[model samples]
Target: MLAIRLVTAPERPDALVLPIRPTGNAEGDGPRATLESSLPAVADELLAEAAALVPAARATGRAGEVHVHLRPGRTPGRLLLAGVGEADERGWRAAGAALARSAADETHVTVAVPGGAPAASVRGLVEGLLLASYRFRLRAADEAPTLTGVDVVVTDPAAYDEAVEAAVVTARMTRLARDLTNTPSSVKNPQWFAEQVEAAAAGEPDLHLRVRQPDELAAEGFGGILAVGGGSASGPRLVELDWRPVGARTHVVLVGKGITFDTGGISIKPRDAMKLMRKDMAGAAAVVAATLGAAALRLPVRVTTLTPLAENMVSGSAFRPGDVVRHYGGVTSETTNSDAEGRLVLADALAYAVADLKPDLLIDLATLTGANAIALGTRTGALYSENDQLAADLLAAIDAAGEAAWRMPLPADYVQYLRSDIADLYSAPTQGAGSVVAALYLREFTGDLRQRWLHVDMSAPSWAERDDAELSRGATGWGVRGLLRWLATLA
Candidate 1:
């Protein structure tokens, strides 16, 4: 975790990061007027010197742009001009990330807060700084991160206290999600994943955790989960985390696909695709982390997180295509493609949530198909919901959280694609909109609760090929922030 705190002024900082915005001039040049006027006398001088060091053509104050000036004998040896395009929340977030990346070797740096910045911008900046600084790797002790603390220099330190605090918790939880998703499959089997979640909940007084082992899973009707895990020696488990506060008005149940490592079962993925299969459990990581965030924030709404853990590996006992498996609520799905196993495990959890928990809102997150990436690209997720209000509200929260997602239509006409002759539905359709078919198939398990349910196909967004803004290079922890933001609205 990064030590982020607000201070009245910089006290002999090793480096100074001054936020700058475009002046809207023809050349798209330097700092905004408010930034220059707000900085202290010393910082004002440093900004001028920094501007002289870098040409205006090179540093146009565009988002995530940085200009550096080295001071020979100054108390702060380095002066960085961080660009916040238009100085909005998104811009501030980009600037914050750029600052963290630029000063990766520094122990501490002072960020000059733009005067009269709103609480949203403060939160965005802090979230970006902390999130972008996240490092996850298995390395020698000598190769640890160098950057440790950030000091935000503000006029009144107490003004943005709440915003800073909230961003800290949100960023930390997102990092937790990333840590879970990035763990290698060799060490992150079904049992190990459940243990990590249990340990996380152990510290929370309001959070209750229950794990259903293989026997318990079989005793209860979780054929879908069992079918997916039959191939792996690690077996399967179902984890339930309940956070119910006194006088909560709404209950939101979150189901996540927890395939610890997906080898595509009998239908094996190519070598390239299987390399990153460790992150197939990204959805489960997100929901589990978000539920913990809700508890940390003390949100007034109740949240129950259900994660079905399994490893889809090829073996003699692996489930095959044409195999009809009965899910938790007696709904059966004929497996059409063994590779499409995420929706199978998710189906059991969703059915269980609807049948027993009866939550007011049901949302499932999964890396269900590559079609979602083909439709919306790698950065954006596809959202499908039966209720317009729920869709609108979730989209709003996603936007405010600075995440990208487009709500796709759940065409009733597309329901025909999921028809299975041998069972209630087909786990994977032979032909159609791959993501749409996947969403519609899961909707079958919801029964009459479809109206309250929303499906997020975040397969692409959950893993990043490279770092961008607040997202790291590995498991991006995509849905956690937006879900937490939506929960806060309900609270």
Candidate 2:
């Protein structure tokens, strides 16, 4: 974690980041002059030097554009002109990410905050700065350099205190999700994942945890979970974390697919696809992390997070294709494709949540299908729900949290694809709209609460192909921020 301090003025830090707005937004002649007037007299020369480099670097003060100026003997020796387009939250977030990446070597840095910056913009900047600096590596000696601290130079630090604190909590929780997702399968089995959740819930006020083992799962009739985890020696786990605050008005239940390692079970995947199966439980990581974030923030809403953990591996005991397994709510599902195991485990949890938790809003996150990636690409998550208002609220939360999610349809026509003669539902429907059919299958488990459910198929967005704004090279921790934001709105 990087240390962020809000300071009224710069104290000659190692690096100084200046927020540069678009051409028309800057005051006092131009961007450089405007920044110069805001800073002390010692920064005049450095600002001029940085301004000259901006055009050479082709930086038009657009978001995510950064121009660096290094002065050997000058005060605040290094300067970074980070673009905050239109001085908006999204713009500030992009600029913060760019700065974090560009100043990776700096130990301590200072940022000259834009004048009259709103709380949202401040929050976005802090989140982007911290999230972009996230790194996960398994190596000896740990020789790589990292950003240590940041000083946000502001006119009135008190005004943005709450915003900064909230940003820190959100970023830390998102990074927790990233850490869990990036861990290797060798060390991260279902039992280990459950233990991690239990450890995280420790010492947190009003947060309760329950971990159900294989025998308990079998006794309670979790056929889907047992069938899926029976192949792995480590077995399966159902982790339930509940945070009930005083006077909470709404109950939101979150279910995540926690396949710690997916070898595609009896139906094996290609070598290329199996390599990244360690991150198949990214959805579980997000929900667990978001639940912790809510507890840390002490949001006035009851949140129950359920993660069904398993390792879909190949073995003699692995559930075979054409096998019909009963879910928690007694909904039978025929295993058409063992690779579609996420929806199966998710069905058990969603059914249990609907039958028992009785939440006002139900949301499930999963890396369920490849078709989601094909439809929305790697940056955006495919959101499916029948409820219009819930969809609208979640979309708004995603926008506010600077995450990308597009609402997909739950077409009644496509529901036919999930029909199975031998079972209540087909695990994987061999139809086009693979993502839609996957969502429809999960909806069957929601019982009468289907209208209150929102399904997030985040297979692609869960893992990043490359580093970008607020995202590292591996697990992106996609849904945590948006889910936290949505919880805040409900609170």
Candidate 3:
């Protein structure tokens, strides 16, 4: 984890020298000379002296590169030139990420943005840098390299404080989620996943955690979870974590699909796509991370987290497409496609959350369908919900958190798409309204609880090569911020 500290405006030391580029025809010497002229008065005549020592190349003002050199008479660090391409937010953010990545080994690094830049933009840049620089190299038994801390020096302290603080919290939560998702399946099975919930809730005075392992799930009639894991060597578990604040009027239930490793059972996935199956548990990771964030922040609402952890693997005992399974709430579903097991487990978990916990709202997240990726492309996920108001609130939350989410319809006319002639329902429809059908299947488990419910099909670019300021190339930690923002609105 990266520790972030702000350098107070009044307490900033004279030793610090920030690099800058010339605005117009002021270009004379190299980047070092230009940066020397831009230094504050507290830093002495070292800036002026350094201007005369460097070569005669002009500074480009790009966002990432840095050139620093010492002057003749100074004892402190040399003048440093930082890129500030076009003085725009995107440029600044990219530059900030590059700076963090370069300085990951340094004990303390400080970033100085010009006075006129938007505080939000600067903070966003810092946030992006911290997130992008995070590398999961824990598996190597040798030297464990980690970033200890960072100090951000902004011109206006007050305007950027709130955003910076929020970013810190978000970063911590994101890292937590990433670490869990990155853990190998052998070490992070369904039981271990349940143990993590218990451990996260151990010190919380108001939190309660419940775990239903394979035996317990079977006793509780969670056949969906049972059937999905019946063939796996590790089995399955349902984890429920509840946080209730005194006098809290609203209650929200969060359900996450935790398929630890998906080998696609009888109906196998392509070898190319199977490589990324480790991250199929991303939805579960997001919900767990969001719950932890809420507890850490002490949000004033009742929140229940339901995560069904399982591994879908191929074996002689694996459930086939023609098999019928009974889920929680007595809903029987026919397995139309064994690969569509995420929805099945989520159905059991969601049913338990709505029927037993009876929260005021329910939100289930899953990397349930590739069709969502086809519909929303790489940036945004598809959202479907029965309650428009709940959907609108979640969209607002996503917007506020700067995560992309789009509302997809749950047309009642499409309800028949999932109908099974022999069973109460089909795990997947024969036709290809894939994302919507998955949402519709979950809706059946929600019952008539009068609570607002949302289903998020996160089949979009959970991992990609083109990185953004806030999102890394892998396991975007997509729903953490959005979930936190929604909880804040409840507060």
Clashing pairs in 1: none
TM-score of each: 0.96, 0.95, 0.84
Q: RMSD of model 2, in Å?
A: 2.6
Instruction: Please give, for residues 1-491, the per-residue lDDT of candidate 3 as tens digits.
Output: 56666664423332333545445443443242244232333334644554543334345555565555543464544345565555555556556666566555555555555555566566556666667776666454755445566566655577787767666676678777777777777678888888877877798888888888788888889999888898899989988888877878889889998999888889999999788788888899888888888887778888889899999999987899989999898989999899999999998988888778888888988889889878888879888886888989999988666578899888889888878899999889878888888888888888875347888988674555565555666677778878988998998
Judge candidate 1 against the unseen true structure and give its global Cα lDDT, from 0 to 1: 0.89
Better of 2 and 3 by TM-score: 2
Q: How much is 52 displaced in model 2, in angstroms?
A: 5.8
Best by TM-score: 1
lDDT of 3 at 199: 79
* Model 3 worst lDDT window (10 residues): 30-39
Model 3 stretches with alpha carbons more than 4 Å out: 9-95, 113-126, 138-147, 154-163, 449-451, 465-468
Q: Name the 10 consecutive residues with the lowest summed lDDT in model 1.
A: 28-37
RMSD of each: 1.9, 2.6, 4.7
Alpha-carbon shift of residue 442 in model 3 (angstroms): 1.8
Ranked by lDDT, top first: 1, 2, 3
lDDT of 2 by residue, 1-491 (tens): 88889888787577888766566534444443223235442356666776677656556677887877777896777778888877788988898898889998888888887556688888888998999999898998786556888888777889999999899999999999999999999999999999899898899869999999999999998999988998999999999999989999999999999999999998999999999999999999999999999999999999999999999989999999999999997889999989999998998999899899999989999999999989999988999998999999999999889889999988889888988999988999888889998998988889878889999999999999899788989999989999999999998
Candidate 1 residue 187 C-alpha distance from true site, Å: 0.3
lDDT, candidate 2, equals: 0.88
